[model samples]
Target chain A: MLDNLQLLFVWAPVMNVQMILDGVFVGAVFALSAYGLALVWGVMNVKNLAQGDFVIMGGYIAYALFHPLHGMGLPTWVIIPILIVVAMAMMFVFGHIVYQLIIKRVIDQDMFTSLLATFGLSLLMQQVINLIFGPEVQIIDSELPILTAFDSFVTIPTVKIVSLVMAMALAVVVVIFMKTSRTGQAIRATAQDPRAARVLGIDTDRVYAFTFSLNAAICGAAGVLVSMIWVIQPFYGIVYSVRSFCDGGGAGQFAGGDRDGVRPRSY
Target chain B: MKFKSLKTMVVSAAVVASVSMAGSAMAKVEGDTITLGSSISLTGKYATNGLHTTRGYDYAIKVINEAGGVKVGGKTYKLAVKYYDDESTPARGAQLAERLIQQDGVEFMLGPYSSGMTKAIAPVSEKFGVPMVEAEGASRSLFTQGYKYLFAVLSTSEQYLSTTIELAAQTTDNPSEIKVAMAFENDPFSLDVREGVVDAAKKYGMKIVIDDKLPADLSDMSATLTKVKALRPDVLIVSGHSKGAATAARQLEEMKVSVPIIGMTHCEAAKIQEKFPKAAQGIMCATQWVEGIPKRDSMFGSASDWNEGFKAEYPSYSSVPYQSAQASAAVLVWKEAFEAANSFDKDAVRDAISAIEMETFYGDIKFSAAGNNIAKPMFMRQIDANGNYNLVVTADDMQFPRKAGY
Candidate 1:
């Protein structure tokens, strides 16, 4: 134990500014995905256990587009953002279909029911993704250059900085959409009081579907960013899921009583 | 209604007949064939290596049969394999091993790919009293269990990285001044590799700067790389299968953390040189077989000959992975034992295998009391300048270590 402490203290000076910078950049990606999870949980009143699988699926979509285009004469700067938008759009449609076929049934049920349902969905999606992509780990091959500082003690890839900017920009767009748009208002109203919103002639079911799709779009965007900056595989979905769940809880508390005045359950 | 019922009866009879025919085809030994059973990971996480292992077995069996089969008691018997997809799950591996022994009546068995799967299947082989020669599973803990029925042809995981230390000592005049940093995946195989490196480093009087556990998923290693950059260890060693190796290579390049000597396991098996040649160059790795070995035998001939035949048959097979070579050697060991025993009896074959000692194109085969290969020495290879592995160190040749650079 003494030796352990001594070692830790000796290594303490080495754990410097660069480590924190890396953690913050990685954590930003997690926050983006978690915001999506929180959006769905808050509006639809359903927990999506397959949230990470959706993210991976989106990553594969971006990879499918980027890998082929990478061999072409197209530049990464031209292909990456375009493919990300395409992936988000594709996931939006996928999420709508998923909600119509499976999640809609459990949306109004107890949290346990939705949990079990989405858990099964998560397993099915993981296997399907594995079959489609084969089990090899893949990266987007963004070919973005690395940036070094402090005589190379601190290293940051340009792709990571791009991903952080994209994540923050998306989060801001989501917040603005929720505060302004008619559909977003319907979603917030339903989350505030579904029975009252139904009595007010709002199509609560459509609102739920739209909110779920929007959440999936957000996840898809985050996944595209993740594919650009880090490595992804079929089985690595659960780690992202756990990270997002933690982020969702923290974000829920921080934003509590500001907009909807509803306390996020202690998930 | 009566005519429909008759049709249904005829269909049912045809189905039963087909089922029985399929079962009989698998069950029959055909008077001139010896069938060995295995539960390989054909469809799961270990599928890539599992494919290599199975193909090795197939190629070896084909070669043996073409060479007039195994002669036992003046009768030649062709070799056949009966394998099931274990799905890379231990429980499934054990279940299939039992099925192979009891239901299929296989007299001999071959082990699975990973050490975990082998550990699960070893007890079943012991209980059924069938001798198994395994090539892929290398976890040292699997040997210490004292199971007599199980044997592994590959060197134990503990020996995987000892040669890196040895290579370091040969390259440097002051070996004690060399500092090593190791990051190993916290799995059975990698943990064993860590143990080997630590022991070997101590023996060579080297200093260990950082020893960290890579998480199971191997998703992130930035923090570890950051520390590595600061400490600037003389050598950086990683042992986390293909994914871990890829992570190390990619992250090392991204972080610009260059060590003088970089050694890793599974650089060839994972095809890292082909995938990321820029990052892969100058990285030395431990392997079970190299192509230019002088060892030869009647069944497989020399290493180059075996590789040529394998590539001719499998045109897309770029490099001869160690998994396939060791797996083919496992079959050769079985053939040698069967021929020496001069009988098909299980007890006689087991005895012959226990007392057997020989060298093949893959390597030497001599099992210790713990059923691990002791005769074969692991060699070191470096990814050369042209994105191909060059044999840097063998039993006969030891060269200067290349420094890691872009």
Candidate 2:
């Protein structure tokens, strides 16, 4: 521990920049994941244990899209952004189906019911993924060059930087959507008080469905970023879910008209 | 209430006993057929290699059955395996092993995909006095346990990456001046691989710059990669099965970790070459069997022939992993043991496996008292520019201090 500390602080302090940059890149992905989990938890009080599987499922979407285009020798930049958009749109639809099928049924139930339902969904998704993909760890090689500084000590993949910027841009788009959009206002009002929102000429069912589906889209976008940066496996969803749970703890506060509560996941 | 529950248990036990007695009517060897049971990792984390193992076993069975089957006691008996998915969990592996033996009436066993799963299943097989010929589980500690019934066909895992240190020492003028960085999963197999690297590093008196066990999730290795950047090590070794191999390969490229010697296990199983073609260049992948090895058996013809046959069977695999090769050899051990023992008795077959010395396409097969293969050698293949593996017998045939992926 002391040796690593010395290496970080004294021996090669320049490496600290690398760590910070890496952390930022990692934090960007977690921010999206946490934001989605928070949305579901804050809006409906439903702990979606299948949140990570949704992310993984979205990554598989990108992977499933990559191979056909890759064979044609299309550029990665074109291929990646297309896949991300397609995954998000598809996950949005998938999310609506899930909402109609599973989440809708348990929306009126207690937290435990929703949690168990999502947990079962998680197991089902993992098995489905394994059956389809054959358990091989997959990654989309963005094929971008690595940018380095400090005589090649602090190296960063161009995709990671692009992912960070994309994450920030997406975060901005989401915040604007939530703050200014009429449907977003309806969703937030429903989250605050479903009964009151329903009484005040708002369709709470549609609001809840939109909110959940929107969260799924965010999770899907994060999954695309994960596929570009880190490798994905069929059963690797649980870790992302665990991290999102910690980040979702703060999401609860963010739900209560407290934007200041939204912060980067510490770990 | 306790007496009433005990009475219910007694009645249940009696019913279970009658069912098992019926199940036992189909013995380990019945009607000119030998039934070998295994609880393999057909799903879960070890599923990739588990599929490879099952394919190997199936291919071996097909070939053996085609070649007039195993002649035992003046009768030819077809070899067949009954498998239950352990789900890559050790607890499930042990429970299934017991079920395979007691309920399914299996007296002979095949090992699971990993050292941990094998560790769990070994004790159950021992307790039941069932003989197991395992191919995949190769932790060195497993060999030290004095297991008479459990026989492993692969080289022990300590040989996995420790040999890379020897190659690293050869790259430098002063072996003692070489620095080693290692990140192994804290599992039974990878930990034992770590010990091998540590032992080799000690032998060369090399400085271990960084020794870290990444989280079992293995989603990231930036923490260790950062340390590697700060303190540039001569050699970086990682072993965490297919997941660890994939994570390390991806992260090293992302981090642009420029170590001279990068050794990893499960490069093929993870399909790192296909996944990260640019990053996979210059990775020293430790393997048990490659395509062109100079070993052959009557059953499988030769090593390359076996590779041709395997790829034909499993069309998806561009490169067959050694896990499958050794698995096929394990089935051969069963066939050879069955014929040699010339009896359906489990103890006789166990003795036959211990006494046998044979040659196979997977290489020479001879077990020491500890039940690990003593004749075979581990091979290191450097991933070439075109994603093909070229065998590196020495430092001369290799690219030392690899080109930075960045």
Identify the candidate with maximal lDDT: 2
Q: Tell me each candidate's TM-score.
A: 0.87, 0.94
Tell me, what's the RMSD of every candidate?
Answer: 5.0, 3.0
Question: Cα miss at B176, model 2 (Å)?
Answer: 0.8
Chain A TM-scores of each predicted structure, in the order given, are: 0.92, 0.94
TM-score of 2: 0.94
Residue-wise C-alpha lDDT for candidate 1, range B1-406, written one tens digit per residue: 9999999999999998886666546642558988999999876557667878898999999999998998888898999999898977899999999888776778798889888899899999999889999998899999889989888898889888888888777776788988999999987888999999999899889999889898766778877787677777877889887678777877877787777678898886667776667677788888988988898887778988998998887775677788888989999998999899998788889888988899899878899988999998888888866777788764234324454444
Cα lDDT tens digits for candidate 2, A1-267:
998888888998998898899889988898788888888877777889999988998889988888898888998878877887898999999999999999999988987899899999998899999999878788887788889899988888899988998888888888777778898788777777779889999998898798789889988999999988898888889988988887776644543445422222222
Worst 10 residues of 2 chain B by lDDT: B397-406
Q: For all candidates listed, what's the TM-score of chain B alone?
A: 0.89, 0.96
Of the true interface contacts, the fraction found in model 2 is 0.81
Stretches of model 1 off by over 4 angstroms after superposition: A1-15, A108-113, A252-264, B1-35, B42-45, B58-87, B99-107, B312-317, B335-345, B394-405
Alpha carbon lDDT at A160, candidate 1: 85
lDDT of candidate 1? 0.82
